[model samples]
Target: MSRNGQRGQAAVPPAEFRSYYGRAVLKTPVWEWKIPAYLFTGGLSAGSAMLAAGADLTGRPDLRRTGRLAALGSLVVSTVLLIADLGRPERFHHMLRVAKPSSPMSVGTWILVAYGPGAGVGGLAELVPSGLRRALPGRLLGRMARPAGLAAAAVAPGVASYTAVLLSQTAVPAWHEAHPCLPFVFTGSAAASGGGLGMALTPVAQAGPARRLAVVGALLETAASRMLGRRTGASAEAYSTGRAGRLKSWAEALTAGGAAGTVLARRSRTAAVASGLALLAGSALQRFAVFEAGVASTKDPKYVVVPQRERVDAGIPVRGDDRAPAGGTG
Candidate 1:
């Protein structure tokens, strides 16, 4: 028997090269700009909800109010973007038909359902008059606000992270391979965006936590992105080349610069505003870069073919037809 276990044949060398009519092995993502926009808005909303819950619990009513309002507004816009991405916006209701733990989309839909009303109630709580708040339903809503906001906060991390999983679950080489790190990267982005909003909208005195959060988030995002790029190896070439690379490069620069600005400009409201805007822009650009990278990965057949061929060469059985042809006597 030969080394490859083929009867009466010498071990065949791997094929030098191959191509399938220069076509893509997988379909590119059909999602539009709405998807990336939804990712940014949803993450920002979730992160803001978490911050609101923290501020409320700590008796920082001003920060709490700012966080709540930000959460509510971002959540509304996020939901609209999500629905717009659907094939038929009206059919979005179908996503709630079952609680499928195996389906990220279903789980995410339910999370949004729970979070939307919770954030809305929390945002509106302080708006009601004292006299009206003492009334029947008003009193009930007032009482529910804290608990609802807390509950939403508890689920907020999942909201921010699930989108990462949603992308990672796909067959896209760049996405599936980076599943372990994508959630962390996205969570960091969410935090930075939420912090940016807080800093931009709140007074300097109340912006302490926002500044701290911005610094921590920026650090986390930068570290995770660098780690992901290093770990993905050749699969990440799509991310490093072409349009995705340009977007990601700008994102990294802006995130780092904004974080530095936030720390240095703590006392300067004008400088802080500029930094906050940069962070927000950076967060959005990161999402767009990831989206574009996944699409690009699918376009190139080598990304799909090479990894599987490597597995086959190593004596591991791949589930699909990924084996490369043997090179004869060359």
Candidate 2:
């Protein structure tokens, strides 16, 4: 016998890990492309709301106008994308029937509900017709605009980060593994997208906040994404392989290019627009890359089995275990 006499069927390595005839262990997310697009728009809206509030307070009328309008437009787009994904518009309103703080999806629904009005009023404040300037309704809108914008800004963080929670809570191993830094990744992407838009639309003289926001967003996104990619697990490999890897690589490159352009934006309007566009593109790609990674992880068996094996080797009990041991096992 060879060594320990391990032979025959036992020597064959257990007929490979076909848990269910090569089928995915977990059901992949049913979300379509619109879901990822919604992720981008939601972040864009949240970030733009905050930027508008900042611009309003800082006496930058052009920036404020641009931000307000952008927030409103993106919010509308996000709603449409989300509704489309649900396959019915009324399904969205149905989600409003109850509040569940413990549920990320539920919380996100509420956040969007709370976010819309403030953003709408804030943007509408900017679009008052010339003839209506002296009207009481216009005057009321003007008076309510600042408070409404600020409210939206206050809620924007939740708007930007909740999507991360929604993704992480799912069975997708890549996203679950990346939970710790996902919020930062998302919020940073949101900021980058919004700031990029600002840089594109606003002139250099009033674009200081946008420039700073872009830089900050880039920093947070790059750092957090690195953290995500560097995570110690088989699942993280999904982030650096196949189409997901390609998307992430492009995202990183574009984001870096955008960050670099921000440095020279003050000197050239062309640079500002170019940088802004790059950052916006990078943010969208980043979201799509993350979504793809999660979906990819669900397809790859290693993302499921390998992690469990690691836990078992470490004497950690899996889901059904009554008590997970603390010591390593042979």
Candidate 3:
């Protein structure tokens, strides 16, 4: 009814935003504390599963036992954490009741179910005495176990990558924008974690694959992170720049140090220890950086706007903008 309305003047500025520092703009995750706990447990399970597969293939029974135990323990912990995260833990069965390819969480649930049981059985087999095991086991038990371990190994890579997809599917700017690189980063971190565990437990002769895995994982992590930093604009600034920045930098340093030390793992016990410690430290730091970056991205509007605007200017759809709701959280 006013003159401004009649003249069709704008009601607000073309660009509007507010800072999110020290405040949450969206739902502050009321689900439960155990969600992140499950994430960590899942990562550990995936890492151990890989180690078990590698040991089986390499003819290291001792390493195989260690790896299988680690995998089983991680699965138990992960199950507990996941159930604790749900408000209706009773509905956990509903997870297996449905199949949805579009859902990363669903895919992860299936992977967990398959890997958990396989690892547990394999671990239990290792625990029983050979005579006792032979009494109940079929002639094909070893064959079945071998293939199951390999299946777990194949899924282990996805187990790491799927978590990234899970987070990126949400409204987190830093996470969604870095989806491509995040999977690779997480895969590398998982490999490093497994390698560290192997180095810590296996004898020098049996530690060959573990060392190579660590070196490859380190190189991959470093490259993926650098690419993420360069590609995502300010959305990924958290990865390289404050507390999160420092953590990411430290992760990189540790990864490099670990890779270098792995080369000398055969030389001496001290070198192996150093390498294992460095890789483990790097894994922890990388996880922390991932969470920190997600939180930081959610707290800043500039990160949401800048990248999308660039995309828009470049004639890209910008539909993947994290602020655009579920349709764009790709």
Candidate maximizing lDDT: 2
Using TM-score as the yardstick, the better of models 2 and 3 is 2
TM-score of 3: 0.83
Instruction: List the candidate 1 regions with Cα displacement exceeding 4 Å.
Output: 1-14, 126-139, 321-330
Q: What shift in Å separates residue 57 of candidate 2 from its native position after superposition?
A: 0.7
Model 2 TM-score, all chains together: 0.92
Query: Which residues of candidate 3, in runs, are more than 4 Å off?
Result: 1-37, 137-144, 315-330
In model 1, what are the clashing residue pairs, if there are any?
none
Which candidate model has the greater lDDT, 1 or 3? 1
lDDT of 3 at 181: 90
Candidate 3 lDDT (Cα, whole model)?
Answer: 0.73
Q: Indicate which candidate wins on TM-score.
A: 2
Evaluate all candidate structures by whole-model CA lDDT and list the values in order.
0.82, 0.88, 0.73
lDDT of 1: 0.82
Ranked candidates (TM-score, high to low): 2, 1, 3
RMSD of each: 6.6, 5.7, 5.6
Q: After the best TM-score superposition of candidate 3, give how far the Cα of residue 145 lies from its true spot, in angstroms.
A: 2.8
